[model samples]
Target: MSDTSERNQAVQIPQEAFDWYDAYAHGGMDRRTFMRKLGTLVAVGYSMSVLTSALLPNYALAEQVSFNDEDIIARYEVFDSPAGYGKGKGYLVKPATGAGRYPAVLVIHENRGLNPYVKDVARRLAKAGFLAFAPDALFPVGGYPGNDDEGRALQRELDKSKVQNDFVAAAKHLKSHALGNGKLGAVGFCFGGYMVNYLAAVDSDLLAAGVPFYGTPAPKALRNNIKAPLLVQLGELDERVNKTWPEYEQDLQANHVEYHMFMYQGAHHGFHNDSTSRFDKASAELAWQRTLAFFTKKLA
Candidate 1:
């Protein structure tokens, strides 16, 4: 079958992606080059103009986020985790009003680590009256390397057990932080989204709500352990992630897990990250609104 025909199953990763990835991994190519090349690989057979246009905006991680630094108490903090792997670092942002405790939301970044866009996302969450923390999954490897390829490479070296612990610890800390009212929620995109799913499943008692954007859901084995409500946003064009949702949703329903899912029409993976041209603005905004409403309701 052609690669397109196997979309219902696992789509094969392109050799071009592997080539660029390898080059980037070995420091032979910069992040921009790798991403551009990877984009071409993703839309194999597409015209060069279309391919370049689709991926450039995404690599530009600093899109215009409305919230200014003054709007929030943005800072870098070293947090203690329950997992005890070691102290980890992350970006913490909250409303500048700084008057009293508020609901807390843990922001997990895409595979690229806690880049400017993800930090901007934390600011957005703060504007919505939640304390947001965007943890660098690569923190233990000396934090986000200021290079996407390097950051991704560092991220691959993490111990899976430690990775989960870091998030769990961050959630545990955020929920009980001096700025928290004991309610905690999480939002993650791409890789981070899947982590949010993992967080929801294992640390259900700590997480009140979770929003996973284009992320994989926790496996069925962990379904019964989920106590928090979930808001799953899916892009219609992302087959790999979409293929797993049906079964996961069935498990959620069977386990009586409180969950809601929305499929954005004619969207692709990473649609919520406006830094990418693949982003569907209308759908992204709608998804964000629903995320806020759901978190407010569930975490309240």
Candidate 2:
């Protein structure tokens, strides 16, 4: 079947199934329970295998820009994060043929650490003419474990504060890197989204721009600390994350933070991610276009 056919089939999945999957993805539900609950969808004519295949991420489809793309160079790099995790590692990508320093972007992954989707995002950023790095928070525990469930479990075992510090350190490292123009921007999804908000909150000097996709907002007190321009992308149906936005907007307005928020009409949480059924192509494309434009206006 064509990819479009598969996506249409995935769209036939019930909303309840997506909710169950989202709950499970975020750790609110265990795998056994998730699988069992998801199995209930079998009554609707979806075999368990088809349900799993349609709901889970297919990394093979995640790449919009190839690692070997002529426009960018990609590789692994390690950096020190003394205050956070001791040693941090990540995938770094940058313009292959550019001579001058480029504005750098730190790509923060979801709760599952530095997975392929996030790496692909780094490559996309590089192709757009920026130095991009995606640090693996699970590196201290042996890296992504080759699967998201295990990866999420590994991330949960780490000291949350240390992980946050690691990202903060990453932003600093890339901003000061020899190949960078000294301006730093960040983009993150899910847990990474929260981290982007956290980064902008704690460090005003490093991040010049930030795009947080449907992640939770920083605490009200910390929200006042943000000084970077923010382009917040949210899904209209993601109530779990959306409930936190009103006060967040008030805080941003009260503090005079430069930010714009767009709530995609029919998109759900994880809408920007194309590897799963939750991906909303139109919304994701529009959001990304806006994101790149915002970066150009602010970072370039």
Number of the predicted model whose lDDT against the real structure is largest: 2
lDDT of 2: 0.89
Clashing pairs in 2: none
RMSD of 2: 1.3
lDDT (Cα, 0-100) at 42 in candidate 1: 53
Q: Candidate 2 at 71: error in angstroms?
A: 1.2
lDDT of 1 by residue, 161-273 (tens): 88888888887878888988888899999788898899888866978899999898876687778878889999987776899998898888887888889999877777787
Backbone clash count, each prediction separately = 0, 0
Residue 70: error of model 1 in Å? 3.0
Candidate 2 C-alpha error for residue 98, in Å: 1.7
lDDT of each: 0.76, 0.89
